[model samples]
Structures are given as structure tokens and as C-alpha cells.
Target: MHAWIIWLPVCEAGRTFGMDSLGGWMFWIVCVCFSVWENAALKVNMRESSLEVVRGDSVILPCSFYTSSRLSTLNIIWTLARSSSPETPIQVIVYDYGQVIEDPSLIGRVAFTGLPLSADIILNYTRLSDAGTYRCMVNNLPEKADPGIGELELSVLEPPSLPDCKWDGDINLGGSVRLSCSVAEGVPTPDIRWEKVNPEEIPLPINMEGDFSGSVQIVNVSSQTSGLYRCSATNIL
Candidate 1:
């Protein structure tokens, strides 16, 4: 029904595609000319960009392209590489072609901004595991072309040491008392747990995200919970 589809079969049915000696040369010439033009255009426009972030904080790396004509193709890639060792240990963080790539480590934490030709990437709830040098590459050229590059740095902070626990005064056998432990800082939000002097003794219900630098808490005092309460924090990183 369509003129182009009907003509395509008719044209291909012929042994020589119904082209004369001169016509065959002209067809190839046209294809070559278009290919050369595309290659030249891509070589003319190329750029680089970058970003940086602290270990606990999140960051967005910008990647974009500049072309003389409106872009019809889009390709973007994000990668992370450790600074140590010489083997170039690189991991693909994201790869996009009209849709975002699904990476298990970055799921629900990565997003793309702006249109296909120009865009910025966002990472959420960063951790020490995310620390590394990153590269963002973009390719939207009509022909095979060099990709645009963007570098990013993620800084991770070590977890702070556990703080000493203290009480106001000595407790009677049946009287209620309170003990506390503190955590200073960490890239990954730390979780607090309480360990008593006696392994068999069960510590009181520990309240987390409590007062004093994300410390752990125990309510309703009892003699069984009175032994040395050790506050421990484990960072997500």
C-alpha cells in the first residue's frame, strides 16, 4: 500500500537493482558523501565537564553536548573508578539511551535531568562505598565520534569512635538508673547497639537516634541491666 515499501521490493527484485553503470556509481557516491559529512560534524563539537562531593554527601555530575544542528541521537554513560592500583578498576554506574540504565547498587538513588542532548545526573544518600573518581561520557553524534567526558570525586569520612558511657551516681538494688553511649560522626549513618557486662544479661530496650550525637538509649531501669553497657555503632558505609 505504501509507495516506498512497494518500490523497495521492485527495486531489489532485479539482479542489478535496475541501476545503470553510471547510476550505480552515483548511488554509492551519495552514501559516501553523507557518511563523510556526519563524521566531520561530530569531530567539530566536543567538550569536558566535572564535579566533586564529600564522603557522606550526595553529588550530581553534569554531562552535555554542543552541536550545530538539532540532535536526534542520545547516549550517556556514568562510570566510577578507584584511585588506587594501576589496572583501572572501573564500574559502570549508569548508561542511558532515551531511558535510564538499571544498576542494582544505584537503584532508587540515581536520576537524570534535562533532555537527551543536555542533562545532569543525581546520586542520593551517598555512602563510603560510593567514594571514588567518576567519569560521565556522552555521545549523540550522527557518526562514530569521541564521547564527551566529565570527572567527579567522592570523599568518604571514617566512622567516629564509640563514646564512653556515664551515669549520674551509684544505683540501689531496686532503684532505676540510666546509662549512655555516644557516636561522633560517620559517612554512613551509624546504628547503635548495647552490650552488657554479662553476656547472658539482656540489655533494656535500646532507643536509637537518641540524644547526643546519634547515641543508643535504654528505658525503664532494672538491676539486671545495670552492668557496664557498651554502646556500639556500625556505619552503613
Candidate 2:
């Protein structure tokens, strides 16, 4: 934020005043223009405010800042509100006067990946415990401006676990069959699919009923329907 100011001074009279004339009063018009930097503080920006990465993978939290001061005077700090303590943020890393100080817990798992005026960082070997909120702070000395801050929410994904498949029905020719599948645990609910996989690999008998959530039903089974079936569950990590 900025403001402009104009100063205008008018003389008291056209004639110059002397020591005895009008009590030595003299004035002249003076014009001046200046700017006031009231809100010229640093600004921080994030390319992506929220991000997700698979467990064990590396991810980058992007951050940048704008400031009128020199980059050499910049100081950066990154903090995390880990899952264990959502309300309390711990300092993860700091960049001060060309030196870096990292937290012991993140000494080997995190790295600064940005240049001057940027706070981008990468987290390596991510884990479910790493999912949390992160903050990036930057300040330039001698500016007396507010520090630039950016925030990001991180999510470490867990892949779908193995699925359990079962069937309930008699082997009789006219018996109805219900094939069901389920995944006991996964970060995101896995998608379930059933497919016929035997006897020349033909498609599942038509008119099958059931939703993708995990089950399929076949009515009036026949010898032609006899085959191997498979159930699969999957989700992106």
C-alpha cells in the first residue's frame, strides 16, 4: 500500500516584509510531492496451497515472496503442525544470513529447494505421520514491514490394501450367486471390481447386478456360467 502527499505554501502578501514592515513577515509559495510507504511490506505467494504425495515419495511445497529490500537481508523459516500436535507448530528449518539450521527430526528428510526470496522446500520419504499443515515465513531486515507468510496443507496417501473376495450360493444350476469383495483398510476407499477369469476368458455373464462398492449378483446360474472369478481393489497412493 502506498499514499501520495502534496504540500502547498502561499505567501501572506505580494510585498516583501522587512524588519519594520508588517512586523518582518515574509512568505513564499512552496510546492512539494512525496510518497508514503505505509504498507510496503513483503508479500508471500504459494503456487499450490494444498498437495498430496504417496508414502515414501518426495514432494515440494512451493513458496515465493516479493519485497523492496535486498535479498541478502532475507530470512526464511519453515514450520510444521504435525499430526501428533496439530495445534502446536514446530520449527522445521531456518535460513539466516546465508546459513541453514534444520531440526533434528527433519535433518535427513527435508531440504530447501528454492533460491533467494523463495522458500520452496522438498520433503523426502514422506510418511503418513507427515500429513499436516505447513507454514513458510520470510522477512527482510531494515524494511520494518510485516513478514511474508504462506501456508500449505500436506497429505500423505496410503495405497489400498489387499482385498478379500467371497461368494455365497449353492453349486446347483438354477442357484443365484452373490460375489462380494472388501478392503479392510486404506487411506482412501478402494474401488472394487469383479471379472470372470476362466474358461477361455469370457466376459462375466450379462445382466449381472451389483454396484462397484463391492458386490455382484448373478441369477439363474447355468453350466455356461461356470468359470473362475476374480475381485480386485485399487486406489492411488
For residues 1-237, write the lDDT of model 1, one tens digit per residue.
111111232244455453444566666767776666656533222233334455546776665655544455666677777544325645455444556774676787777766655656677777666667766666655545454665666566666566666655336655545566667665445666676656564544575545434333444557655556666667654
Each model's lDDT comes to 0.57, 0.75
Q: Compared with the true structure, what per-residue lDDT tens digits does model 2 show for residues 42-106?
A: 87887898998988899998988888877787888999998668988889889988888898988
After best superposition, candidate 1 residue 46: deviation in angstroms? 11
**In model 1, what lDDT does residue 99 have?**
65
lDDT of 2: 0.75
Which residue runs does candidate 1 get wrong by more than 4 Å?
Answer: 1-56, 83-96, 144-147, 158-237
Alpha carbon lDDT of residue 108, candidate 2? 94
Output the lDDT of residue 58, model 2: 97
Worst 10 residues of 1 by lDDT: 1-10
